[model samples]
Target chain A: MVENTTHSEPSGDDIRPPKASIGVIGWLRANLFDGWLNSVLTLVTLFVLWKTIPPFFRWAFVDSLWFTDGAVCRDAPGACWSAVTTNLRFIIFGFFPYELQWRPLLAMLILFFLLFYSRDRTHWNKYLAYGWVIGLFLMGLFMKGGLFGLTPVDSTQWGGLPLTLLLSVFGLTAAYPLGVILALGRQSSMPAVKYLCIIYIELIRGVPLISLLFMGSIIFPLFLPEGITINSILRAQVAIILFTAAYIAEVVRGGLQGMSQGQYEAADSLGLNYVLTMRLVILPQALKIVIPPTVSILISAFKDTSLVVIIALFDLLKTSQTVLSNPEWMGFSREVYLFVAILYFLGCFSMSNYSRRLERELDRGY
Target chain B: MTIADAEKVPFYLNPKVRAVFFQIGVLCMVGLLAWYLVSNTLTNLERQNIASGFGFIQKEAAFEIGESLISYGSADTYGRALFVGVLNTLKVSLIGIIATVILGTIVGVARLSSNWLVSRLSKIYIEVMQDVPVLLQLFFWYAIFYESLPSPRQALNPVAGVFLCNRGVAVAIPEAHPAHAYILSTLVIAIVAVFFLRRWAKTRQEQTGKYFPVFRVGLGLILGLPTLAWVAFGSPTAMDVPVLQGFNFTGGMTLSPEFIALLLGLVLYTAAFVAEVVRAGIQSVSKGQQEAAMAIGLRPNLVLNLVILPQALRVIIPPLTSQMLNLTKNSSLAVAIGYPDFVSVANTTMNQTGQSIEGVALIMLVYLMFSLSTSAFMNWYNKRARLVER
Candidate 1:
């Protein structure tokens, strides 16, 4: 039908569109007020916005008690942001000795700086790898502190932003290589290897991260020799790695399947060995094609780090809960939770936007 | 030159030989690690004097579960308590999946609305929901439901015979009698008969090129059959209207605050992902296809139902299945709010019996089964959807 329309030669009347349907007003008419149903939808949406937005604005900002005491906040008819400011320290660095709190703060800054540095794909090199290693080592040193004449803090003391970053950053980095291996194993000609990979991926993907963390914190201890303790934080980290790797493996396998078989045949015809063929011909394209899904997996892995709270490790979310649990600041949970929500939103939203942009840029050649 | 060209490569350099050797090496290493762990666990259990295995599941569970679908007491065995927990988990997850899909599909269609405000609102919702961590959302809703509601004595009666309080939302439900069994069985039989009727109708339509009112007929079979059975059985179910008696409401179905909050959190969070899936699925049906359908004089609704939806569903079902699986697994987060879900109950059992291994294993097994069943159903749907081609 469209072919028939296109095949017919256009006359003068067909070439010139109607004048009332060409500008911004015309767009509004066509899209928003195109018909009776659309007009009603527009009015209903406007009514909903009018009913909700103004009150939210007034409560969140106009009447909000941002810099005040608990008593003052209680008297106020709006949000009590004082809950956030008053307990900011506890929320950001839960249970780290009060005087040495600067260490975690420093560690978090380093992580953010490293993350900012790595966002530029043009700077991808061995230097970036070295920088991450150095930065992560520094962060660990600052948190754990067995060297540089600093007093040692136990792993139990590690909490808040540093723990969240450590879990997500390390978890994703470790998971990616492991995921690639598993993806390869799943595609291998060796039946045992293929089945092993398939089973591992499926089993891990089957359960929730909470169950995995529970296994790490409670059940894994049973497997260890008596009195040989692994810290709860590390165990949870391992669980996150295992869980995330399974998902990432599937995403990577999708990329692998997308590659043309001709590329493999060409490499084989060139007398390239299996390792050389995969490393030179397959992996680079496969990994590039998978960047968007990989980033999504990373983003969700970052969010799943919050589940460590179930194991009683005080990551950012748990710390916020602790802040609310204080009787004096109990009624201001709305302010505290929203504040934490913003932090997560910033991380997730930015990664997703990056993925979209990267997808667009990669699509250019196609 | 011929001698050098004909020379054979060493066995160590052969790729196939190396691959087999690597596999054997890995297997042995894994086997050794497993052996070491098992041995360590056996000795550790011996030292702690905590005998291991599934024997403890039969022991009496002294801990109280806050909510249950079946009649449960502290006197029940650990196995029964866990079963109650499983039922609770399934209850919330089933409700969450259904609610999320409906909400997601609406928002997804709204995102494509010609009304600019509707699409923008939907976009904002998806962005906010996609970004926030779900556990935090759960906590946010839980906090609101737990603290912000009025006390039981002054509970908000938003509608007739319904009460909402910090405790929970209570509404009227039907009280079942002995004759309800007969009614239920009759309804089930009617539903099976309707399923066959629809199949026969479709086959007839295909063979004869005649339209049948299959949907309306099926609906009548479902509703009329159930109503007739109820009447025939002397109205076996009676309304159990809730009444404010003393400090709290009595009678009717009570949705616990924990269950409601968890339901809202899981549904809202998973809906965001499902919305994106739906949007993608709908958008995947090309504009050309819609235009072609319209050119054939098909109405807009018919174009959607007959042409667009079948194609959109092909794209939608795979991701939809994953989202469903995710919602089910995420019901475990009910533990954070003391929802007494499978994970929470198993955790309690583990703490009481010191059988952490078995408890964790059971949780994993249950989740695996849920995942497998969902995937199995999806696979069947995929096959059916594919059959629509040609």
Candidate 2:
């Protein structure tokens, strides 16, 4: 009976999908050429890519000048990537003493280590927080060295990538707690506190960061006592902190508003005070819910740190501009700016990707 | 357990008492800080001999604005220069918002296209645009305009009467005439009429179970009224084509490179965020809604308009309002790119007069006014879009 069945009936392997409905051709047909309109769109897009990509590839790679001097680059028919390669040190560490470049570089490595180590959800604990605190301390010591047998560098001399990182990371770290407090104050039942928090948030958020930086650079000194001057970097950092805190407060407020009444009532029924309720019950859940958005705020704040260039702070963008203004690097603004943009893009992209992953990981619990 | 017992509770321990005391304490601390800052500011201003008041706004600006909507020169007052800056800011922001909405909507829709290539391309565009800083993009565009584009003498004239050069885009436009104002007024009147007509049409459709071609009629009125007004006032058809004069073009509109770069960067960068918002809004409307509408014999276009869009827009408008506000705020980055926006003009004023306090205050006031007005409008719109519950 088995031999008869095998000879007369077709097996599962033989009864496969039709040739037109499976494999690469089917994929192409289904995805790109499903209908007349889609087919036309596919053709048009292909044509556009065909026209643009080859020329761009030639300009950016094939004929590009990588290590040449400005004179050769001027006559070259392609991009002068040497503008970035030659000024790499200045672009990364700004005016920090030439020999002491390793300090910022080392500090950056430590920052990256801390960041990478904390990326996994399993590693998230109080120890990770402690790691950040210690790592930040080391970074500070390295950047401003007086006790480690290293040359003391002025904060004004701190510029470029490290400065961008410092402003965004430290600013966000400091801002988060203040933002939480502000959010709590806004959500409080006390009218006076709520109004005060609301007004502060609204006022800070109404104006752009440029105006705040302007205030820091131009108007902040007037608010200080005579003979006491804050450095420009510190002023900018403070402005960033205040600006970012306002946005963070708004985001956290959304988280707070999203909590169900039942959660609060349950906490109350458990005889918990407001602080305990928020800390142990409400905030833990609310903060988790808002993690994705808070990361977005952080990403934007990181990008906004580049605005310090407007006030003449030698952040990465400003350093790139300085390089472009050089006689040797003249007319190579595109290469330098492109390089700086890629740096910023990488930082932002990785953070956004992490946020998305975290969102998915958190969603798994539901 | 009695009210008397509650009143007898320790004042420090009573929640209400603690709340009042906390508030009072906050107020006192805030008042003291404000007082200290003001005193310091006054002392510093006196020491620096920098006059701090709005009176400086009336002084001659003595600085040339690259471009201005109104008639402005270096001889203009600081107030007038600032007004020009305000106008420029409004011009860029309004134009940027419109362009961003259009481009963002298109990209957002493209991201969901049935064609995989189209969707992937749009996704890449969004990711790249969103990741890059807007200021950097502005700088990049500015550099391209200045360093890549040819000189005015060798401008790329893709079409007759249009010039693309390092200087800016010079385009031909219809010469201004008095009749244009009358036609513009009629256009506004037609728009108002269309609004009421739409309401009436909706009401009629609900009560009498009949549809009115409100859209077609509105379009006809909007276009026909403006045309009739133009004809009645003697159709002025004079064209003011840009012509090369000396090193630059004159006699027609010339959009400065700074404005172009700033507008392009702001629109491109903000459109990425708006695209995400739009995608989320569209996705929020469930597939069942579309299926149900189709089952009820509604046309595809009608299903999209009557069922999907109304639902989706409710999800769209709140975040979209924030995106608009963000675009407006980011336009302040024009200061970096040499666009004589409000912040740029204010910076110049601050530097010239050393009245930093007044300049900062004015900047804050103007921006706050913008934010408040926008939020107010959006709040009203959100109220209208909200679902009506029984």
Candidate 3:
């Protein structure tokens, strides 16, 4: 009887909907538990989450000490948030005059605002260049204030997020032009120029940044005339600039290699000289193609500024380490390091995301 | 095209003349700069009373290194101390590279998994790890390990014969025994045997149109032969399990906390980049490939092994090599945490002997050698990976 019923054609009104895997439950069944192995994996992942997350939440949030003194946190069973909050000012402006902390604060604001303004490629013109020049001058004036009646803060006293931004911004800005010139020189018809560029780039790229920083601190001073001392921070900044230029030269050369031969011929037919041809035609297109990789180099260079810690410069990372080294806040390195990591993540992530967006927007069909 | 037209050009305007003049200008400027710098450096060295030469490398290095691959002491020669540092750097880099490849490949493939949870978790891991500076991560990890772990007296014993404490982590290993040499010889033999067996299997399959399970057979030869040799030799090697002593664990192998932290920092940070490279390489292979292989009745594993990976390797190897080199260079960050790597050792030497130039030169020379050798190997691999056409 059941077989006969199945054999009969279904009436239109009695027709049933087909079962489909679409919603959350369906998705779980299809993705998480599609087979025995997947089911096992899903269970294992759940078990791991179960083991780690609850305790993490409890330690980080539920029982965490906030807005309290070190004395209160001494016996607390969870994280000491008060350590970071209490020493936040010291961490942000290491060794700078406590009263003049507002200067770095203002400088950071200017730097960030300028960075935000420069993100718009359509507005990239002479005005943008002028804006960077003015912004950097203002930042330097505010931080090193022997002018305008503000107390002068020595470069050695510069630290924390402001120092990080200063190093990365100035290092990248100064390095880009030098890198482009080196790349062009490497491609020159003259052997002397080409080999000079090659040796400079290769030799710099061969050594680690730490050694370069050491050279800047120790060996470089030896190279200078007697009693002609540079600011330690200035030395480190120059080291970063030279080190970054080498990597950027390699990347720019790659971009140059990507340019079609026809473009070169077109420039030649237009009667453009070498510099004119590269500036008016080659660089624009080549630079556009290399934006993603260039941004990557810039981001890594930004992070490499943290290596200034080894040279005893109190950059963001070094400042955090200084904060944790205090006996009162010694056990609170987790909170301090976490805060520093968040700051760096914000800088690096935004740059990378912007680069991806630029890559997508600039990709005009080959 | 005429002689008169060529002769009419001014010297300044001539491209050839300009090129030659520019080259001369560059050479002169470089020569002047070098002359000035070398003269100034010589003066400074004389003033500072710092002897500048490679001779200082042979002097006794009185500072202790926290970790070294080979036996090293404060009494070791500066050259030997530097070599120990190099070995330490290589140890971290080699192990880090291996761990990174495996972790990167897994996370990379998981990024493309149909499982929503798996892919999202992988994506989150890559993004978070990549965004943070590695030095900061190293400090964080070192601090966490120190804070979370109990003192040596109350060290956490998660497994038998393994201890974890603020000092470090100690894991058990098989103690060297009399038959160890025989066991190693057997391993070499197994490897050679597998190579020949694979060749024979390939030839036989080509002739008879039958497939042999070469992988399973090869695994058996490599693993089984060594085990068999060990058993026949009366199990000469035994586990050298670590045990908690008064102040520290004594026994098998102990990794210093600094080393652990640096290794974690380098491997985790670089794996994120490696994962991206892997994902890009796999994506560069067209989607039609898997379908084509499947239509030909190849199993899923065979489809991946024979069709997908070989093509993907061409895309992956270049970026992967660069990431490896990056990781190698990054091991220098060991200085930040005082891990006694090459840079750290060199820094000490410079400070002690006041030989900054030679010390820095030694660091640069070693790293340059590493970078050149790595790139040379990659170039060779790239050539082998190139497509062959009739």
Candidate 4:
């Protein structure tokens, strides 16, 4: 049974290390190049790189169909940059009114800048306050435009990236507080409210968000008074808001439930009310526990903005679809879809990576 | 002293009084909001002349699902259509869950392999799969796997002339004979017997460190007994291999592109999540546990079986349960791929009948039931597999 078996666990102060290398490099040599399976996989991956990477580089850069205007794409023999150029506005705007496109574009840029600037350590908390006040004021001034001698853009005209960003930011900002309250309410000792929150959370969490969105699309109108009608964008936002709140509640509730009851007792002993206890002690821990899931939910919501297309709201994917329907570039479906996929991938991938890092950071204690 | 203790809570500091005041305020705000919304809905519905209620569920559907498990067509009632949708959703979830678990476990174990390539490949799979939006993955797989398939005339017969094409795949299937029913019955009986026997063996093992060869026995009982009956039943089912027909193949079994795409996407997307769960589960078992088993003179395999795996399963099963729930929920993406899952069918029913309220309610109820059952099943499993904490 022991005939010439050479495998053994290397010792800790492995004197000469079984040759020139036995740790990382030896392990790699023994694993990757040792067998046909590994070799084949290696070859396959290399082959894939060779095949896809070159063309990717070429089309994206080297021989790219860039900057020759919309008409030059036909002769370019690579990815049609012309399609992106011509359709870029629609792709980002969805259906926002053409006249006030600058407002949304500005707002989106400001939000992006705010997110980046907020992450900078040099600027204290006051910067965010300034950004918020000025940013919102400017956005409102631009969007409403009645007092600025700017052409007023209707909400219906909001189409692409701006709409998607606004919806997501609004949904997230609204959902977080609502979600926390609901999570707290669900975990509360109250007989009526706890049951109510539980029912709401479970019912919402059980279904696909698309179903909720569909319900909202259909249900929002039903909830409106006879004479007054809400805009479709607002209707969509309501669906997203409720759905986001429910999901965020679950995430927050996870954090809440994970907290040892000792923390609550300790807070209670300190004579702190529920609000003060939560704000000071409970929320910080729960927020840490649920950070990764919260980010993922945000990412998911970002991705989910595409689903609004199903309800006839022209988010990015819808904008892409609109591009495809163009009579001039009718058959260029692949290019358009790829562009949309790339944009989505960028957002989703970054958040997923960030979540992984956050999870690691959070899990250090565990 | 009790009276003094009761009076410790000042009027301003009375907790019950505070709760009441806060709740009343909350209730007032909620009531006003609800009142506004309800009045608005009433006006809207009345103005639109839209009659609400679920009477529309009984109306004839006059529509068809591309893929139907149960007997269904355009002639079916709306209720029947909804049932078909529910069945489709169940089918996708069940199949997707099973496939994802197997694939995920395989990939997860591979990631721990001494083989660097295997681990790297698994990592790549997880990243690529998780990075792309599921809808995009669905479309990608649908386009690549199904839409790009050769025409029926050029069908690729990978196994026994099973032709795969844009329409679907056609394969050989057995035609059931009369005696086949007895064979199936015998199989069921054998499986039940095996289950009971396994439970008995487990108890016996626990009672006296003498382990029964339950795996071998159960396998033999389940497979052997049914196979014996199959011969005795005179081979009722006949093999029916798909034949090349005019533009398409005449089938034994068929899988539409929509079903294929939905299953592929669900499996691919979910397997990444499951791999992470499996990895975490394995990692959760501390090295000391394995080393302790080894120090006690057990072999590596025995160490894993006796100590590491048992403890790991405790950690694994909980999150694994949620992954299953996620897989089940993700099956709703079937609608996007045009595979008439429950949601899609419900949507169609809603649209045709204009009974949005009823349709939405039913969708929620069905999903609730699905999620509830899944959670219940997980709880039961968790209890059964619970660590024997002293």
Candidate 5:
């Protein structure tokens, strides 16, 4: 097929594209200035950034007063970062014995370690579950500290970041199995159990979390016999668990419904009992399908732990408020709030990012 | 032999028998717990001498609410105060839902923009707003409103008849007149007419391959009819401009600081979630659909209206409804900012009357009613939006 035609192949250098269509300039043209409207939009955004960024930077960093006393901060023209830096301990650990603050810190470190370890799906097994159980017990022991010759700090003393993590983490851990059970009940053929589960789920979901918290605080006390009292923190914890379980049940129910009828029929053909079928076939797939949504629910529950502040518990948000209420730190609310918000943002952002990654990974498997 | 074997099965081992037994056990346990709790509650109430019924709702509230829709005094009954709270809650939720939809749509579209900076900025907005705890955001906004704003004497008047101060934002509104009522009625009529016109146009388009400019006509009818009514009744020009009197602005309508802070926080927070829902909805529509519409010589806007939105809306509505319900529920956070919402008012009632049971029950009942009604309406709308299949 070598016809005698006067043709020559292009060299690599000749094949190279023009500079205007490949590098940073190319990106700018294609993404930021693809059309007249895009170019205008790019310019307007830049203008807005120019207007906002400099002032914010100057206030937050340049003119900010850090490592200073309240008297000095009051006179400063910008943000008072000292409010956060000086009271950082109180803000992070709250009213836990000041000398024993390391206990709570250690507890949080363990919690974080457990969370980080569990992030890898390959490590998710019976040992990980055992690890969580042991870790939770250690955390409680450290926070309470009656055993191991440690000072006996009451549950009432628990507050700040540790308290926030404890409520959400403990609440979610206890809630997941209950939520699954509720979902199974809702899907059961027995009308009584199904209706009961439906009522419980809808009742919890219909009202706001605050209402349930109110019942916990105000009505639950009256429901107890005289001289038998429960701590407000425990009450709030119960409320959060009950509230979150309902939401998780709904998400798990979606997963259950999404399972094909063929899967169930196959289990039946294998002569598996209902429990065995659910345990070996249904729940494994359903729970995996619902991991992303369950994570979302957990993240929201984490955020909602702040609502305990309304009930007068000293979570991170409440600690910040307590600090702000002091006469010495009266005017540094913006700084204190910004710091707390960053803490919350980090927790939420990481969880959501992990969920997205997990979603993609799960998608690849199928 | 099969029937005889089934009858020979042990009652405890039979699946149906076990199911019945389990249900009865659950019912018994639940009933026992309820009985125990009620007995304890009664004994405790008697010991504390706290009146248990809702009889306190008739008593004088004796506490002044910071804001109310209707004229309310400390002498007003608790029932009246509760009603006012419900109205305030509805007002905020309705306005917040509308604003959230508008802002969320804009942000969602911007996130999909071809412009890099625009999309990036919107992404940043969604991330930051979603990541922050909403209660914290509410506190932030409330701080800005209460701490940063100037006093009434030093109010910032950025426009002619608008005042911004620590007290609240006061904006001039048209003076009340009979013509205003007529104009409102005319607007309602125009809305009804447009509804019928849309149906007629849809049928006409289906029967005959023709298009109708229903939007333009509807807009014209709504606006023109209102204007005509105003003109026929001698168009009123007077406005109730705000004027500073004593320590506060008088005359113009003032949005309380609590209301503004609550509204702002709810809209900004909920809009982020709504934007994500909308983005997912739009993305769910395959690119081929748009290309196919464009291939048929439809204009870009026409492609969106005729092909894309109808499909995207099906995916958007269900999640959007939940977001709306979330906003409604989150409005209960108004208690944190002291916004005299239903929960806050009920909380006050509980504290005052010591009728915690009644107060808590009312709160649950009202919220349940709201949730049920909202879901019912949304379910209807979702059915309408669903794809029709043979």
Candidate 6:
């Protein structure tokens, strides 16, 4: 636009370009030092970066140990990731029979493939729908073992990333149907059932996740029959599933409430039964409306899985922290924590981007 | 009209029958699951013989809390110790919420600024923060910030006699005298007087189209009343500024780095969400309000203060309330950094006494109370904030 104006009036050679700035320097000025306040901020930020970067450089590369004889890390001035480099296998899969590690890794790859394939809208309604169900069974059999040449790995030994992924994936999938039922119950014809659903959802949503996990891991035992103990990781999985169901139920209910009375009336006029109405008519729209918020909840559930480290289940965070706890890896906490943090951030950010894309695309529908 | 009245009773398609069947199916499945877990726990407990009940509440905690609302020590009951822990959680979270809301609003507005640098800085801030897990952020601040401070003897920032150190910041507390107490009482009286005066001023303005200086009155009342209090309270105990006491600073109130780190992390994290809510609320208001206010002979600030905020607040409060609730829940992450909050104390009690159910129940109840009251207060505020739509 500025260029058009400048060319139309060739009164002067300079013509005072709207953005006279050029190249990297111009971009920096426009972004970082555009005004007095911005220039001040730029200086402050530059100072901070200058102070922080060199130490990281020295620690991560120059002075740090990348590989060692396991115990030779006492002399490093910066990061000591030698322990992580050495013990990454154990951290990724704790107490799992070492030979069985390949099976879990393979299962992870298949999960990535299925999820990647399903993300495409064309694939979503086609082959991926069937593949998702099939993939779950395959991921399970391969990871837990009972199929192929893999040795059976007990659920108790399921630690680290594999366990974290299973808990979150199943937590979201199981919660989807359970949450819809709860939402329907909350909107039920009977006051007793409606009120009960309301109270259950609100009460569970109000408290912290740690308390729920605590209830499942410890209190849940008391209400159960003798001699049928659930494993720790399984208990945590149940905890996340129940927790996510309560939250997603609320979001779905909000979506249902947002729908106009006309839609319901139309469905009623068509002589659809309640089940048929919800499944074929109301829920399809409501779920679409709630897709954005529910996706954020899914992301939160993924992040919250890290909290299981507290109960001593070795999820990604716990495994990293466990590695930190060892005297052998005492000096490498910063490097290990940062590495794990990057992995978490990347996973969450990509999902957030996808959800935003879904929101925009779905919102375009009538 | 409503699906034509069904004179003949429906068969299996009857809603009642379907509901009953579903309930029975769910109940049976739950009952089986319950049976399995109960049997397993009883076997596990019996083999272990862990006495389960709330009898542990009366026992001595035998663990000292670094901070307490009511004086507590190892000699105190486990109940008292748990109370102390809950108090700490409340103390940290309450202050954290206040700080976060203020900071979040500022940063949120900054992110929407016409100024290019401020907006970019805020965007970067929000991105860098949430990407890092909050627990790790808390550790980064705790380990990297205060842990890098100079020793007490080397006291970094000296204010009057106040000292900052790795040992913690020691601040000056006022030593009140009789005059200071009188001043304090006078200040409270001044505030009440200012309140009455402002109401009269507003009434007068409505009647006569003349405005009273409300801001000046407010400032005078708040500052003068406080000053009068200081004089009346007998000049108070001159702050017992913590002088460097060997390896640690001593004498004044000490804020543990754990508290600092936890509070900062929560504030920084919550601020990002708060900013988004604020931005949305502001954007939700029609631009015509600004134009209309300008047409009516109002300044930009007047438009914002008198016209815009009144509407924007209705949009803002619901999300803001949820953000506050989130901050309260996230405070439990204090355990990761060893800041002995409610769950931490309960955890210790549970581990030592093996009274898991009672301990967890107490913690849940406390959180429920906090959450309910917060939600209730927000609902009342929303009612007040709602548009009359007349």
TM-score of chain A of each: 0.91, 0.96, 0.93, 0.83, 0.96, 0.90
lDDT of 2 by residue, B1-390 (tens): 999998888878989889899999988998999999999999999998887679998899999998889999999899999999999999999999999999999999999998999999999999999999999999999999999899999999999889999999999998999999999999999999999999999999999999999989999999999999999999999989998889999988899999999999999999998999999999999999999999999999999999999999999999998899999999999999899999999999988988888999999999999999998999899888889999
Model with the higher lDDT, candidate 3 or 6: 3
Range of the 10 consecutive residues with the lowest summed lDDT in candidate 1 chain B? B1-10
The TM-score of candidate 2 is: 0.97
Residue ranges of candidate 2 with Cα displaced over 4 Å: A1-14, B1-8, B229-236
In angstroms, give how far residue B214 of model 5 lies from its true place: 2.0
How many Å off is the CA of A337 in candidate 4?
Answer: 3.0
Best by TM-score: 5
Better of 2 and 4 by lDDT: 2
lDDT of 1 by residue, A145-183 (tens): 989898899989888877898899999989999999999
CAPRI rating of model 1: medium
Indicate the residue-level lDDT of B318 in model 2. 90
Show model 5 residue runs off by greater than 4 Å. Answer: A1-9, B1-7
Worst 10 residues of 2 chain B by lDDT: B5-14
Identify the superior model by DockQ, candidate 1 or candidate 6. Answer: 1
Candidates' TM-scores? 0.93, 0.97, 0.95, 0.87, 0.97, 0.88
The fnat of each candidate, in order, is 0.81, 0.89, 0.78, 0.58, 0.84, 0.50
The per-residue C-alpha lDDT of model 6 at residue B221 equals 82
Model 6: reference contacts kept, as a fraction: 0.50
TM-score of 6: 0.88
What DockQ does each candidate score versus the true complex, computed on alpha carbons?
A: 0.68, 0.86, 0.67, 0.43, 0.83, 0.41
Worst 10 residues of 1 chain A by lDDT: A10-19
Q: On residues B1-390, what C-alpha lDDT tens digit does candidate 1 reach at each position?
A: 586664577889877898899889878887899999999988988888988789988999999999999999999999999999999999999889999999999999999887887898999999999999899999999998876899888889888778899989999877867667777787898889988988998799889988788778888888888788778878754679887788777899888899998999999999999999999999999999999999999889879888999999999999999999999999999999889999999999989999888899999999999999988998899888885546
Q: Which of 5 and 6 is ahead in DockQ?
A: 5
Candidate 2 lDDT for residue B352: 90
What residue pairs are clashing in model 3?
A: none
